[model samples]
Target chain A: MNIRVADDLTHAVGCIDVTHVSISLGEEAEAFEAVSDLSFAVTPGEFVCILGPSGCGKSTLLGAVAGHLKIGGGQLTVDGKPVLGPSPDRGIVFQQHTLFPWKRVRDNVAFGPKMRGVGKQERRRAADQILQLVGLSGFEHFYPSQLSGGMQQRVEIARVLINRPRVLLMDEPFGALDAQTRNMMQEVLLDIWTEIPTTTVFVTHDIDEALFLADRIVVMSARPGRIVEDLRLPFARPRVSDLVTDVEFVRLKRHVRGLLRQPEKAPQLARLDPLGVQEA
Target chain B: MKVIRCLIRGCSVLSCVALWQLASSLHANLGVITFRNVPPPTEVVESALALLKSPKLLAHVGSSLWRVFAGYGAAAVAGVAFGFAIGRSRAAGDLLLPPLELLRPIPAVAWIPLSILIFPSSELSMIFITFIGALFPIILNTIHGVANVDRRLVASARSLGGTSTAILFEVVLPAAAPSIVTGLAIGMGTSWFCLVTAEMISGQFGIGYYTWEAYTLQNYADIIVGMLIIGVLGMGSSWLLTTFGQALMPWRRAVETR
Candidate 1:
């Protein structure tokens, strides 16, 4: 995989753009091509969902944008600047709860800023604010082990948001939770997203989840993963908790499911480029 | 309920004493030879009481304690630093491990003669033996801890903008702590055992010195008493180490309770 930006392509105003991205894992036997020739632009404060079968590098794409993974081919530039490494501008929320067992909820949230050289006094204040935003106001001194699974995930989000990242990369963040708690977490995430309108890339396998949370859903395919479809979610902005019962949300879920079912044993998914290239 | 438990324990101790007396009476000649012919438990207790009152016991205990603290302390610090390096870096682990594995199997007490030859002072030699007793276990445990730390933790930290050094200190150390602490506890016990063996080298210090001196004099009662003292001190020190170590590990009992 190789990435080169044509010197003439002008930057879109206030959006994170990917110019012909191709991601590969390694030379190991049966080493699948993860993400292939995928490109999309996330506008400022855009909530985009990359939905696919498990292990198709949806998280890898997020990792690339977050500067955690090296881009084999593609430039993920935020605000006309290349992502160097994980800067405070790109905070990632992990699928499994990554709260450090040693630290209390408050200190865990305070970690990124503390690492980024924020003053102790100010970082603590910001941590408190983020904790409050994530609905963990009273759990400041509580350790991760003391909290339930749902609460632990909340701490994970609060920890990332404390840094005030411009792009929030979430990799199946609520996949481990029970259905009831997952839905509750979805609602909490929406509330948190509302307060700080960071452009979010949420990667998940759940069709209902993609519809519930995303502004645009990019359905991905197996193995040499490429965008199969980019379904623009018609659900209105500030997605409410009640949207689960919305008729359009059900239609959207069925529509995404139909697309997913078509590619189960298919030879390859036709690559999608919403800008110009209509078909193979 | 606590009193009843204590009373039961107390009764068990009394029963043990009674059995000892009963055995000694039945085999009077052998019982006399057991404490090297110093009569029985009654006579040994008298000698132990007399020795307890003497200031010599303090000097012996103090010197031994001092040697262990110096040696074990140095070993723990060095072991942890080097262990983290070996654990985190594949290059370093490969470079260092073969020699360490070779050196580790040689008993720490086996170093006493070589340590004496290498260090100018016997005092330093004893400390060196103690350090050897501890250093290997601590380093090996620490290395295993760091190397085998949860992969997700490293990835998660990387995703959160953590540098290699930051992840090593923050995530790796904390994750490997329980294993490292177990190594340290084992290392301390071994160090103490080596300390006693090392001080028996005609040095006029430590429990081993007193123990050897008692054997030469053949004051059988004192010899028995000395052995008992060493056992109790070793047990006491280990207990302290484990108790202190447990305070750092809140997760241990938490899992059991869970």
Candidate 2:
């Protein structure tokens, strides 16, 4: 399906070939702006994390990318096309685990391709493949309510991944998980991302989580949220969790923490500025 | 525990029958409240057995079942349809629901006079009364169900490439299934109620008509039999509906398990 161009806001000319390019939220009259002059891009197969304090509209930005929210300013494009509304190409994983409770696990995973008019046999095959990838092959017929929180989130991830989206947007998908499960899920997510290598925009509050999974971490500031620090990680792919204790990892973690603590308002004039903060 | 509970239930029913029999026996001797018109348990049981043997009893049951099912089926279809329209669309709700809201407060029994005049035949009038009786609960609960479906589900469905029609059928309908089932259960009950009332008020052959006719003929035993048959039918139908509802709601079974 062709991605239709959305009417531009007249404030800025649109950018091309960028996943999640400069989507802002809120009208000028709103009590407070949710996101302001927020600009970012995700290269194909790149894993980017948007880390911020709570209520900083990181999720909102992710929502815009997923086409669940309308951008009030600038534009968001995927593959050189503006996101007029929600499309199958941009899949979203909500923190609440929005698996259709009535459907069995496999059917939930198969829903996207079914909606996209794929034949039942093909979608079923795809669903089984993805469910196996998520380690939920044995749970094909279990309802969402019968699963644990962690298992349900796994099903949620599998459901989105089955769509083979251009960019997978996740809003703190492991925030509700226990510490151990969260670590495990982080690993599983990385494994899945590596296998498919779709462009992904993961929104999270945990600095360690951002540091662990992101090839590039965009640290956002609170209220009228804008990207404050855009740092690239040099950690090798298939990096182990033990790297959190690595000397360079520790130094970069501390540095990112310091940047987040600085309370620097994202200068609008310096827009398109990447902050260029890389940890060697 | 299961055996003990069953034994207790049996004892309870036995005691109720014994008390009823005792009350009937004492009525004439004590010169107290008129249990004189009420038949003893044995006489009622005999009448029930005789009625079961008779062809006329089957006709009464058949007619009542037909009226109840026809009215209730129409109510179910129309209620869910209108309910979804009202719940999902603002314009439909604004235009359609206000008059329904106004009419809703008037009892179904109260519509008997208007229904008789509106429909050409008494059978249609009786069905109409039952329709009115069943309509409200079904429509209201369905509206509540459709209106309260998790918004995030709709958003998620859209992101997954669901069109508006697909979202309604796949997401909204299933999410609202529990509430819709509750509505159907309640609608069955109200339909039975109004069916009996309409059957009693109007002419011919039904369990309700049988009971009312027995009253006029002073056949107290047959009256009790008719009442018992109606009770059994209502209980049986509602039980079936509840079982159907449970089958439709497998997700609820998981929630109920804990």
- Among these predictions, the greatest DockQ belongs to 2
lDDT of 2 by residue, A1-280 (tens): 4222363534232222333334443345643446667667777677889887766677777777777766667767877778788877788888779999889898999998898777999999999999999888799989898898999999998888777777788888898899999999999998888887778888887889999999999988765577788899999989788989999899988988886774467433211101111112
Candidate 2 lDDT score relative to the true structure: 0.83
Report the number of the highest-TM-score candidate.
Answer: 2
Q: Model 2 over residues B1-258: C-alpha lDDT tens digits?
A: 999999999999999999889888776554555677778999899998998898998899999999988899999999999999999999999998999999999989999888989999999999898899999999999999999998888888988889999999999999988999999989888888888888889849988899999999998899889888889999999999989888887877877784
Tens-digit per-residue lDDT, A1-280, candidate 1: 0111343335322368887787665456844456677788889778899998765667778877877666767787987888777665677777778788877788888878767667989989999988888888898987788889999999998887776666788888898899999999998998888887778989888998989999899998775677889888888867777888998888878878887775446565333221111134
**Candidate 2 fraction of reference contacts recovered:** 0.83
Residue A25 in candidate 2, Cα distance off native in Å: 6.9
Query: Model 1: per-residue lDDT, tens digit, B1-258?
Result: 999999999999989877666666565456335522444678678988998899988998899889989999999999998898898888988898889889988998888888989999999999999999999999989988888887766666765667677887788888999889988988988998898889888367788888888888877677778788889988987898788877877655454565
Query: What root-mean-square deviation over C-alphas does model 2 reach?
Result: 6.4
lDDT of 2 at A228: 85
* Candidate 1 DockQ vs. native: 0.33
